[model samples]
Structure formats: structure tokens, C-alpha cells
Target: MKIAVIDAQGAGLGQTIIKKIRKEIEKDIYIIALGTNTFATSNMVKAGANVGISGERAISSFCRTNKIDGIIGPIGVMCSGSINGEITPLISKSIFNMECTKYILPLQKHGIYIPGTRNLQIKDIIEEIVFDIKNNLVLIS
Candidate 1:
């Protein structure tokens, strides 16, 4: 399976998610790290993503053409003008239009609050995400 992990800004969250997923999933799943900037992509790559790419066009084009099985990122990924206005319209549109399962981390700092997820820590949230992917794989198989 191929999964894309998209992030921006400092990429701390994306790095954490990549590390956790690598530890939890023993299978040879390809993890692509897509970032809004070079710093973000570099951090995720250091965290063990199979491949890393940056910039608006790179992200949009890859999502538009790639056969990604799943995508994981903050809620800002789907919101145009989100992530301190770093998420462009094209990036948001491409991500939203992609035919893949999406796992969004609920971060209230972006002004996009997910109900019932207010108190969860980032680690717990990532654990849930990994669990969901594992369960989905079982179902698919």
C-alpha cells in the first residue's frame, strides 16, 4: 500500500506521524512525504518516509496523478487558506479531489475544530490513525 503524509510549517506533526506509522506497520507500505516547503519535507524524510517532495505544484501534481491508497495530515490540508495561509487553493482542491482514504489530525490551532477530539493528545491521535489503517487493511484483504 502507498500512503501520503502531507504537512507544512515546522513539520513536527508529520514527522511524529511518520515515525509512529513506521513503528506500528511492519508491512512494506510506501510512505510519501509531501510538504509545503523544503524544511517540512526534509524533516519528514529524516523521520523515515520512503520519498519526500515539496512545493505547491509538486504536491498538487503528485496527488492529481498518483494512485495513493491513503493520505494522512492535519485538517489544514483540506482547508484553503489554512496553515497560516500556507495552504493554497490548488493544494486543497487537489487533496480533496483525490480518490483516497484521508486521515486528518484535529488541530484546533488552525481554527478547524473536530468535535469529540478536543482533549486527545497528538500521540493518541496518531495511534488511532495507525489502528484505523490496520483495520482497513484487514477489511480490504
Candidate 2:
């Protein structure tokens, strides 16, 4: 299975998500780290992402052309000017257009809060993302 972990800023969340996927999933999954900046991409690459792409054009281009099974990232990924203005309109549009399931982390900083997700730790959220991916694989297979 192929999946994308999108992030911006320092990409700490992306790195964490990638690491969990590597640990929790035994399948030979291909991970793509889609970051809004070089630093963010590099961090996820160091965390074992199979491939890393940085910058808005590269991210949007990959998203438009690739066929991914799933995408995990902050809720801001689907919003323009999100991630402290790092998320571009094209990126948001591309993510929205992709034919895949999206696993959004409802981080309060994004300002589009989801009720009942509050008080959950980042580690827990990452686990949920991995669990969902595993469940999805069973359904698809």
C-alpha cells in the first residue's frame, strides 16, 4: 500500500505519523512525505519516508499525478493559507481532488475544531491513523 503523510512548518507531525506507520504496519508500504518546505520534507525523510517532496508546486504536482491509497495530515492541509500560510490554494485543491481516503488530524491550531477530539494526545491520534490504515487495507484486500 502507498500512503502520503502531508505536513508543513517543522513537519514534526508528519515525522511522527511516518514513524508510527513503519512500526505498526508490517506490510511493505510506500510512504511519501509531502511537506511545504525543505526542512519539513527532510525531517520526514530522516524518519524513513520512502520518498520526500518539498514546496508547493512539487507537492501539488505529485498529488495531481499520483494514485495514493491514503493521506494523513493536519486538517489544515485541505485549507488554503493554512499551516501559517504555508498551505497554498493549489495544494489544497489537489488534496481535495485526490481519489483517496484522508486521515485528518484535528489539531486545534487549525481553527476548524472537531468536537470530541479534544484531550486526545498526538501519540493517540497517530495510533488511530495507523489503525485506520490497517482496517482499510483489510477492507480493500
Candidate 3:
């Protein structure tokens, strides 16, 4: 499965998701780190993502062309409006609107415009995702 992780300015949340995924699932999964900026993407790559793309054009183009299985990031990942206009909405819209199953963290005030999927802690969300994947796989077999 190809899981695209979007990070704006390397809040370090994206890396946490990748680490949990690797520990929980045995299947081969590809992580495509899409950073709203260079810093975000670089951190994700160091955290074990196979590929990393930074900048607006690359991020937009990749999301438009590819079909990612899932996406994990803060809700601000959708709007792109940051504190000082660092991460713009264009980058966020590209990934959020793309055809991918989304598991977004609630980070609205922190520059993520997350409307739904709120009030949940990061650890709880990650646990849910890992449990769901494992349960589904077991049922299938």
C-alpha cells in the first residue's frame, strides 16, 4: 500500500505516524512524504519515508497524478493557511482533495482547518487505525 504523509514545516506529527505504521503492520508499505515545505519533507524522509517531495509544484503535481491509498497529517493540511503565510492553501488542497483515504489529525488552530474528526488525541487515533487494519486483515484471511 502507498501511504502519502503530508507535513507542513515538520511539526513532527508525520514522523510519528510513519513509525507506528511500520511497527504495527508487516506488509510492505510505501510512504510518500509530501511536505508543504522542504523542512517538513526532509524530516519525514529521515523518519523512514521511501520518497519525499518538497515545494508547492511537486506536491501539487504528485497528488494530482497519483492514487495514494491513504493520507495522514493535521487538518491544517487541508487549508494551507499558516501563521505567517508560510504554508499556503494550494499545497494543502492538493493532497486533501486527492483520491485517497484520509486519516487526518486535528490541528486547526495550529494552521490546520480541520472541521471534522476533532477532539481525539493523537495516540488514540493511531491506535484506532492500527487496530482497524489488523482486524480487517484477519477477517479477510
Candidate 4:
């Protein structure tokens, strides 16, 4: 299975997700770290992603052309002008257009809200994502 963990800024969230996925997923999964900047990408790579790519064009093009089985990231990744505009419009559109299962973290920092998810903590959300991937995508793909 192949998964892409997308993040911006310092990539703390992406790093966390990669670490959890590595620890939880027993299958031989390939992880791609997509970050809006160098620092973010490097941090996720350090967190054990198989490969890391940064910047708008590279990330957007890769998402548009790659065969990623799953895409994981905060809600900001889908919104243009998110993360103080670090997530470019191309990046958002490319991710949305990708033909893959996407597990988006309901992070309100992007000013977007998902009802019923507001009460869930980050740890809970991460756990749910990891569980879903392991139980569903991993087994099927």
C-alpha cells in the first residue's frame, strides 16, 4: 500500500501521522511525505516516510500523476489560502482531483468545521485514520 501524508508549516501533524502509521500498519506500506516547504518535508522524512517532496509544483504534479492509494492530511490541505496561504491553489486542486481514498483530519485551524467531529481530539482522529487504513485499505489493496 502507498500513502501520502500532506502537511505544511513545521509538519508536526504530518510527522505524527507517519510515525503512527509506521508503528500501526504491519503491511509493507510506502509513505510519501508532501509538504509545502522544506522544513515540513524534512521533518516528515525524519519521522520515517519512505520519501519526501516539498513545494507547490512538485507536490501538485506528483499528486496529479502518482498512484497513491491514500492521501492523509488536515482539512487545510483542501482549502486554498489555508495555513496562511502556504497551501497553494494548485496543491488543493490536485489533491482533490486525485483518485484515491483521502483521510482528512478535521482541524478547525483552517476555519472549516465538520459536525460530530468537533468533539474528537487529534489523537482519536489519528487513531481512527490508522485503524481504517490497516483494516480496510491494507487488506484490500
Q: Which candidate is the best by TM-score?
A: 4
Q: State the lDDT of candidate 3 residue by residue for 1-141, as single tens digits.
A: 678887776548888877787788747677888887788888888888889998889988998999877777766666556534655777777876888678766654763444555676788888887676566556646
Q: How badly does each model clash, as a count of residue pairs?
A: 0, 0, 2, 0
Clashing pairs in 1: none
> Could you list the CA RMSD of all candidates, in the order they appear?
1.3, 1.3, 3.0, 1.2
Candidate 4 global TM-score = 0.95
Worst 10 residues of 2 by lDDT: 105-114
Q: How does each model score on TM-score?
A: 0.93, 0.94, 0.81, 0.95
Error of 4 at 110 (Å): 3.1
lDDT on C-alpha atoms for all candidate structures: 0.91, 0.91, 0.75, 0.92
What is the TM-score (0 to 1) of candidate 2?
Answer: 0.94
**lDDT value, residue 111 of candidate 2:** 57
| Superposed Cα deviation of residue 32, candidate 2 (Å) | 0.4
Shift in Å, residue 105, candidate 4 = 0.4
Off by over 4 Å in 1: none
Model 4, 40-105: lDDT tens digits are: 999999999999999999998898779978999999999998998998899999999999999999
Q: Pick the candidate with the highest lDDT.
A: 4
Model 1 lDDT tens row, 34-131: 99999999999999999999999999999988998899999999899998787999999999999999998888866566789878988898999999
